[model samples]
Target: MSTLPAYVVFGEALTDFIRQSDGRWAAQPGGACWNVACVGVRLGVAAGYAGSVSNDLFGDALYMLAAEAGLDMRFTQRFDAPPLLAMVPSTQPPEYFFIGEGSADLRFDPDRLPVGWRSAAQILHFGCISLAREPLASKLVEVALAAHLAGKRIAFDPNWRNLMTHAAYRDTFHVMAGITDYLKVSDEDLQHLFPGINQREAIAHLRALAPFAQIMVTRGAAGMSLFCDGIEYTQPAFPVTVADTVGCGDAAMGGWMASLLRQPDAAPATHLRFAAATAALVATRTGAYAPCWEEVSSLLAQQITESPHAQ
Candidate 1:
């Protein structure tokens, strides 16, 4: 068995402060890239999240969670700065703002990562507000380019957040899109990234920007569509009694990327179904829940057996 990670995600790892209906705050270790790395590792891929976090209690919780979930911890770094945080004042409208100015996540130092990690990483995933912030954003972009030049697969999800301005994120998006092998975006993300444009035009814009990338556009509850090799494969969302969708996008991205790496020759529908099942399972749990390989496979198996097309 190799010690190398098949999937390496770069971005911020922060604590999410969700306000409860009772006027209290609850803290959860969450970040888009962290969630993706956790999901991938949980789903049986050798994965790691490369970033910096504060050497405080918040960062301690994130570090412990990553270790518990089997993430390659060599890629994690701790800084003596303030911990990054996502303050969520409301959940109904999905309102959030980050508090990480000069914080630890922004101080990510790639040079500190384990030596030879660049070459050992088979697929490098990048996205979220990490790409929209300064210092960290520029560093991550260079890292992505280095990974691309090394002939490694690139998986990106803009995972657009409210903090991103179209001007800043648009430039980063174009740069990453050009090198991305697998790109995931939500309909909501497209709305924010390409506002003043309709959904069709938005996707068209993405296709034009990332001509060779397999773009996965997810429409919650309505399902997802894949634009691959100039063909479109649409699949309905895997239904599950709803819980929290916070981790669905990460689960979907992790699932699809894992499928692609595991079975490079699998059909698009097969990949989409696997990804959707993984995400659906996450939606049935609270927080950024990561499903193991057995759980994802079991859900997929049950769905297949229930499908009308089952032979």
Candidate 2:
């Protein structure tokens, strides 16, 4: 089998506090880039995660989960502080509460980046809370700019959270956008970050900001749209009985990256179809669980049967 392209996902990895029926809580390994890395590895992609973790139990669990998911762990750091935690409210629209103060994830230092790590990666994916903090955010910016100068493909998912209202976060958003090659943002994210801006206006604004970048906007349930190479193509999301919406977007990102890395010259429509299908399937399950390739293949087949022109 041909070796898949290497992917480096840099950001925070934390425990997600999920609500249970008994009014209790269950902790699961999560974080946007972490989910993407897991799903990418499960999809047969060579993936690595770069970030810091506390030397606590939660951090150890994350390390174990990353190994089990087949993610390369050479660059992960463990510190003496506590691990970051995110409390996710169980509702139709999820709400996030971050609880990380002087935690390990925020202590990531770019100087400690693994030796020869960037040499193996074809793409570097980063965003979310990673871009909202200090030291780490500045370090990520340095790496991203260096990668861009090296002509490597860069994938960015703003994954904007409410905390972005902070000046540092907003500033990083614009700074990162300039160096991104592929940009993904949710409809809600766009509105939250740039309120009073319509989709068309947002697209135009982003295009002007990063003229060479391909922009993708995902609308939950409705589907996603791609604006690239001076054209727009949209793919409707697959129909599925959603058990939980967690990890669905990350699944989409992973699937999209997998397809693009495998078929660099494929049409944007084909990319969107694969991503949307994978995301829909993920929504049918709970937590950060990812469907196997066979499951995605079955869904793709069904999608084609339902809409012959999907690709």
Top TM-score hit:
1
Q: Candidate 2: misplaced stretches above 4 Å? A: 1-5, 305-311
**Residue ranges of candidate 1 with Cα displaced over 4 Å:** 304-311
- For model 2, what is the C-alpha lDDT against the true structure? 0.82
How do all models score by TM-score? Answer: 0.96, 0.93
Tens digits of per-residue lDDT, candidate 2, 147-251, equal 889888899998988767888787788878888888888888888877898977877787887777888889997788888788888887787898888888889
**Local accuracy by lDDT, each model:** 0.88, 0.82
Reference-based lDDT, residue 61, model 1: 98
Residue 290, candidate 2: alpha-carbon lDDT: 72
Cα-based RMSD of candidate 1: 2.3
